[model samples]
Target: MPTALNRRSLSSLAVTAAAAALLAGGATAANAVPAAGGATAQHRACHVHALSDGRGAEVCRTWTPHGDGTYYGTWQVDRADANVIAQGRFDGKVRNLGVQGSYSRVKDFVTRACDSSGKRCSSWA
Candidate 1:
C-alpha cells in the first residue's frame, strides 16, 4: 500500500505525463498542417495566465471555428488574496463571460487555455 502523499505524487506525475503527451501530439499535428492561407483550419487553442501581487490582471482568449468547429478554452487570474480555481471542457462553448471577485484571498496565480486543436497555451506573471 502507498501513503496518501505518495499517491498524490503519483497522480500529479500522471497528469503531467498526459499533458506532455497531448502537447507533443499537438505540435506534430500543427507542423503537419499548413496555417499560412487558412489551410489547416480556423480552430485554435489559446492559453492565458495572469498573476499580480499588487495591481494587475490577466486575460486569455481563443478564436473558435466559424460554427461548431470546436471550442475549448480556459482562463485563470490571481491577485494578492484570492482563491484559485481552474476549469476545462471537452464540449462546450460559452463566450463573453465577465469576471468579478475580491483580490484579498490568493497568493499566486495561473491561467491555462486549451482548444480543440490540442494546442495548450498558458501565461504567468
Candidate 2:
C-alpha cells in the first residue's frame, strides 16, 4: 500500500535512528572510564622565600602522600641567608621551618623528615 518513495523515507529514518543509537552507546562507553574508580594520583609543591642583602633564606616545600588520601608538608631553608616569607605547613614542631620575616642563618636546618600528623595539603596545596 506504500509508494517506493515512502519505503525510501522509512529506510532513511531507520538508518538515522540506528546511527543515533550507536553514537549514544559510544558516548556511554567513553564516560565509563572515570567511573571505574581508577583515578590517577596527583601531587603538588611550593617554595617560600624572602631574600635581602647577602643574608636571606628560602626553602623548597613539598607534601608526602599518606596513601589514605592525606598529606604532610614541610619547608626548609638552605642557608641562614635564605630569607623567609612563609613558614610552609610545618605545624611549628620542626624546629626552624616556617614562614616569617627574613632568614639570617641556617638556624634550624630541616632534617627532611615527615611529621606524620602534620599536614598542609590534603587533596592539593
Candidate 3:
C-alpha cells in the first residue's frame, strides 16, 4: 500500500533510529564502567557508517585492561579512494590509523572514520 518513496523514507528513518539507539547504548556502557585509578573512562563501541563508494568504515574506542583508552578503526577498500582514514581526537590531541588499525596509546574522546577527500564520514562517537 505504500509508494516506493514512502518505503525508502521509512527505511532511512529506521536506519537512523538504529544508529541513535546504538550510540546511546554505547555511551551508557562506557559511563557505567570505571577506569583505572578510579578515573572515569570515555570509551565507545564500534559504529559503522556507509561511505560514498558504497563501502563502509567503523570507528571504536576501547579501554585496555589497565584502563588505557585506545582508538580502533577499520574500513573496506574503495577503488575510488586511495586510502581510508580513521581519526580519534580528544583534548587537542589527535591520533590516526589507516585501513584496519588501532592506536597503541591511551588518548581518545571521540572517533570518526572517513573516505578519501572526506567524501563520507561517520558520526562522531
Candidate 4:
C-alpha cells in the first residue's frame, strides 16, 4: 500500500509541473502582438515627400510583431526617382512594393522613393 501511495504522489507532482509549464507558456504568448495576417495588423508609420516639380514620394515602415526581431518597408512614387530601387513593375512610378529584411535590423531592408526629377526623395523607411 505504501509503494502504491508513493507512485500516486509522484504522478500528481509530475502533472502539476506540466500544468505550470503550460500556464507559463500561455502567459508569454498572450502578451505578444498579433502577426500581420492575424486579427490585428502590424503597426506601421508612413511618410510623404514632394518635390519642387509637383511630384511626390511615399514610404511606410512596418514593425514586426513580438518574437520577430525585424521590420519591413514599402514605398511608392507619383512619378520617378533616380535613386528609387525596385523590381518587377516598380520604377519609381505610381506603384508600391513591400520589402522585408532577412536580418534583425530594419536598416537591412530600407526603402526609398523619389520624384521623376530625382532631386527630391522620401526619407528611407
The global Cα lDDT (0 to 1) of model 1 is 0.28
Worst 10 residues of 3 by lDDT: 1-10
Q: Between candidates 1 and 3, which one is better according to lDDT?
A: 3
Q: Each model's C-alpha lDDT?
A: 0.28, 0.29, 0.43, 0.36
State the local distance difference test value for candidate 2: 0.29
Residue 101's C-alpha lDDT in candidate 4? 24
- Over 57-102, each residue of candidate 1 has an lDDT whose tens digit, in order, gives 3333222222233322323232212333323222232222234221
State the lDDT of candidate 4 residue by residue for 1-125, as single tens digits: 00011111222333343356567674221123343255422333344444455544454344333345434333233233444432212222333353432223332334445643445555543
TM-score of each: 0.20, 0.28, 0.42, 0.32
Model 3 misplacement above 4 A: 1-27, 34-44, 64-82, 98-108
lDDT of 2 by residue, 7-42 (tens): 112223334444565676742211122211554222
**Model 2: number of clashes?**
14
User: Against the correct fold, how does model 2 do in TM-score?
Assistant: 0.28
Pairs clashing in candidate 4? 80-115
Q: Model 4 reaches what TM-score against the true structure? A: 0.32
Order of models, best TM-score first: 3, 4, 2, 1
Q: Name every residue pair that clashes in candidate 1.
A: 47-113, 47-121, 81-104, 81-105, 81-106, 82-105, 82-106
Q: Candidate 4, which segments miss by more than 4 Å at Cα?
A: 1-41, 65-68, 72-109, 117-120
Clashes of 1: 7
